[model samples]
Target: MTKPENTGYDYDVVISGASLAGSAAATLLARRGVRVALLERHSAPETYKVLCTHSLQACAYPVLDELGLVADIEKSGAVHNQARWYTRWGWIEPRAAPTGPALPFGYNIRRSTLDPLIRSRAAETPGVDLLLGHQVTGLIEEGGRAVGVTASTPRGERRIRARLVVGADGKDSAVAKFAKVPVRESENTRFAYLAHFRNLPLPGGMSHTWFLEPDMAYAFVNDDGVTVVAVLPDKRRLPAFREDLEGSFLEFVRALPEAPPIDSAERTTKIIGTVNYPLLSREPTAPGVALIGDAALTGDPLWGVGCGWALETAKWLAEAVAPAAAGRGDLDRALELYARRHRRRLRGHQLLAADFAKARPFNPMEQLVFAAAARDAAMARHMYRFASRLIGPRRFLNPAALARAAAVNIRYHRIASRTARRPHKVA
Candidate 1:
């Protein structure tokens, strides 16, 4: 709905792209008494992301819990808790300390399940209007600031005026483009392919990852006991994968250490793949508009971070703008705070993810830390915290943690050297 050519507006916050990030922010802000208009281009309620592994990091638990989604997610049969990783050194399984609290677990529900569930939650909330099939056409600019958006809906072209506008659109964000948000781009040298299988129960029913040097593969136990297996190999290996799609996918899985039994399992879905997704980072805020999720930043999906980051970034946006959206504060200051919070929480992880997307072997620090993680349960937990996006580099790669990892590796080497020199028992 259009507003008068003045300070009046239709919504407190008008968010484009009502997927995970947009729905989340909409729900949270509405709960805080802000009227929100959540818009999505896709008209079908069942249309969910197909090319995702659906792994949410443990760090996202608190946010999901606050949304009252954990029980429903669990009821939908989403796998809970830890992921076991395979490195050349060995497996790194997250372990709890002897006398502390158990770590929070992540989920592996399909996007087909998660997207609709969360979207429904937002639509049911008191102050949110879920506008489906509305394609964003442009932004309404007022004095060098975005005042709202114009969209082509099923009805007709509608102009929505709001105090704040949010772009929760995916990696290729139309809202970010319309706002001319400053952006930096990096290229990823790996290509990815993934599919779902049934009756593929993994060891301990946990999600597994293979950090095979420059290549990475995953087997996640999803809802209804289905497993999603994926491989992100160097771009150089793309031809072989494309040449024999099913054969290559199965071969990769079968070659992993203590791999799951995919041979007897039923292929329940088509192999989906993507090549050359750039590592994108855009300035999150400009005047009256803000961006969340992939609109703000999107890195290599090899780490399975998009879902968790989407939810968590929504939390950041809601928290930053709640007061302003409630008509109690300045919207621009809220945007600035949200921008600072976004950078502080995720920029380091973005940098590191971009570095690894180069498809090179692990750096010396990565090698040492990963090797230590494989051997030491504590180190595994520590590294898992970082890998899970629960902690930032400033904490994970600090001198103290590095020193501990170094000490553990040193001990492992000395023991290995002694054992090698001692004997083979003349077997």
Candidate 2:
């Protein structure tokens, strides 16, 4: 382990990252009167990576509401609505499915805007100390347990000792690295390129996703008249993309027939790309530390599950670990329960996402269901429920739905075969 330059230890809970998961955890823990220190590598509170599409699905809204952020987010002009998915077959429309009274749909907010808002709120909460410009360089170990973090800042090296150390540092978490936790890689097929565009005419009040067989694209209307556009392609094509990110990204989105017409729109930011970052997780908890957000697990962005998962994990860990942190019970046992609950709640979603990311052209079953929805409003509603995460994969893939999907696939294939045998029609 690399030693930090300066070291003076203090604090009850030290968090190594100050992004979504770290900030959320700090807010909740501080509100409960637990002394918290949030450390971030960046000096500017406004500094945030502009990588995500920034769409928060409905599954995450409840967690946000519980954090007292829903109203603030809405006031910040976040878009709230179900996104419309356009496949080769047809459009999957939105439907209203109630999870609870206080929650109102999903939201789309720029991470650049949202990150600072969250961090500011966390700083204001009592019992929390926000330390910017501090980079965590090593973990402080006491008797083989992670008791704190050693970080370097402008003032030099300092050690923040705590009963618990939380690693919310994201996918490439240094905490995860230092702990020597094992990560199991999945078979990842898709690579993504994302950018923001201005003067793009998006479907009013709803986001859009176009599934073009092996390729997928999406656009969301976020705050500041900006639309977040992303293209997800097979991993083999990533090399060409890396060479000329902007050109390749535009071409990919333009090729999707269902994507918004953006030929005239101007790219407001440089295109960003991520390739082969497959969703994986080790044990999220060990000894005196716990991992949340992308540190715990990273799923396919195709579903826009990252932010929601981050918030959810923060809430779960906050509730699970608070009592133990307060000395009411064994902290180790609390972390074990947190790990079990986190896995149990998210295992189904992670498994499905991993399988889907293989990027095989949609199988017959998928075609059937999508085709059925094109022809039937009721089927579309069912599909919407699944897409919005109101229903699990098992319920969505029940016998009746599967049978209909299979029948549709067989019929579509026969038609395609006949069409291939015929002369090409003039446009």
Candidate 3:
């Protein structure tokens, strides 16, 4: 672990934190022949983020396939799932569309397995220097622009320089902090609690989510016969959860209509919880520096979009900066393009996610749409697209779509009223 001697502008990009975002960016940049320094605090390759729900939504499938990791992941017994949403009105099951190219299905695998898989691919890439056990302590700035970083490692303190520095770190990012980036946060109204269970009598590889008024619960059937069950309740219910976590978790699960038979299942892991996780957004780009994944935007975990966003933002970064890093374009202009791309893709989604994180009851329009989705197959497809993040909030809630949903709801209520008034024939 001795400090290297030739450390002058050693790499094209020095990425902080070797999580999904950092590793993915390193792989993409390296494959394009750009030198990359990937810094990770965890020395072991197998170590992973333990609190993850381990769900990858369909939106990330193209990136996974492009990275050539999907086949290996499936071989490791990942579950391919389609989500079924349960509302108080009824259950809405979205069928895979029959049109242009089959829609992608989501995958569920433990973080213990998935994280190492991607990191191994990255470390083996041609020009990526995997600097394990390196913790970023501060940013190296020149002329008001980040040029490199100072990190503490087993060897000692070392300085590494690069043309661009990427903060692919998590919500509390050291690189972002050192660079003095501005972050805006919105208060979270609910807290999440979850655990893995075995032998929970549920359908195969299907995600079931129950929207019970203001509270929400989900059971995702995952690999190796394990199911991840999670609940999100308002902060006002914290006392009930703190009293007896196990007992209260069971009580809530049991209360759901047609709930999974968790009582017969064995708990495979200790209950884990995350409290007060606010919706966070930050300026994603600065001169000679950029942020991706949770470092850019951290939304509510109840939506399960974190992993997908991590992969997506990394790919976007590579598309924007790799050419410049390889000496084909201007670095400053590339960073600006990346910033605009980030907002175009995620800004609307982030705003909607922040509002939903408030845990408010469904509004009149939402109720109408949900009821229509339950009764109509076509409407369900729209709901699925929006939930999967395939479509933005503005497109999903357009005037034409809202008018159609209202009409469908009116038709459904008229049919129900007529059926109730009809007399039963005597046998």
Output the number of the lDDT-best candidate: 1
TM-score, cand. 2: 0.87
Candidate 1 lDDT, tens digit per residue, 1-427? 3222344888889999888899899999999988899999999876688888788888888889988999999999998847889988999998888897887688989999999999999999988888999999999998998989999999999999888999999999989999998789989999998999999978888888998878989988899878999988898988898889889988998998898899999989999889778899998899888999989999788888888899999999999999897688988888899999999999999999999999999999999999999999899889888977888999999999899999999999999999889956675
After the best TM-score superposition of candidate 2, give how far the Cα of residue 406 lies from its true spot, in angstroms.
6.9
* Residue range 1-427, candidate 3, lDDT tens digits: 2232354677889999787889999999888878899999889988798887688888888778878899998998998868889997899888855675555676888888889999999888888888999999988899999989999999999998888999999999888888888999988899989999998877555889988768889998888888999999888888989999999899999988788998999999999988789988999988788999999999788888889899999999999899897667899999988899989989999887788778888888789889888988778988888887788888889998888898998898899899999999999
Question: What's the lDDT for residue 252 in model 2?
Answer: 81
TM-score to true structure, per model:
0.96, 0.87, 0.96
Q: List the lowest-lDDT window of 10 residues for candidate 3.
A: 1-10
Order of quality (TM-score): 1, 3, 2
Candidate scoring better on TM-score of 1 and 2? 1
- Whole-model lDDT per candidate: 0.89, 0.81, 0.87
Which runs of model 3 end up more than 4 angstroms from their true locations?
1-8, 97-101
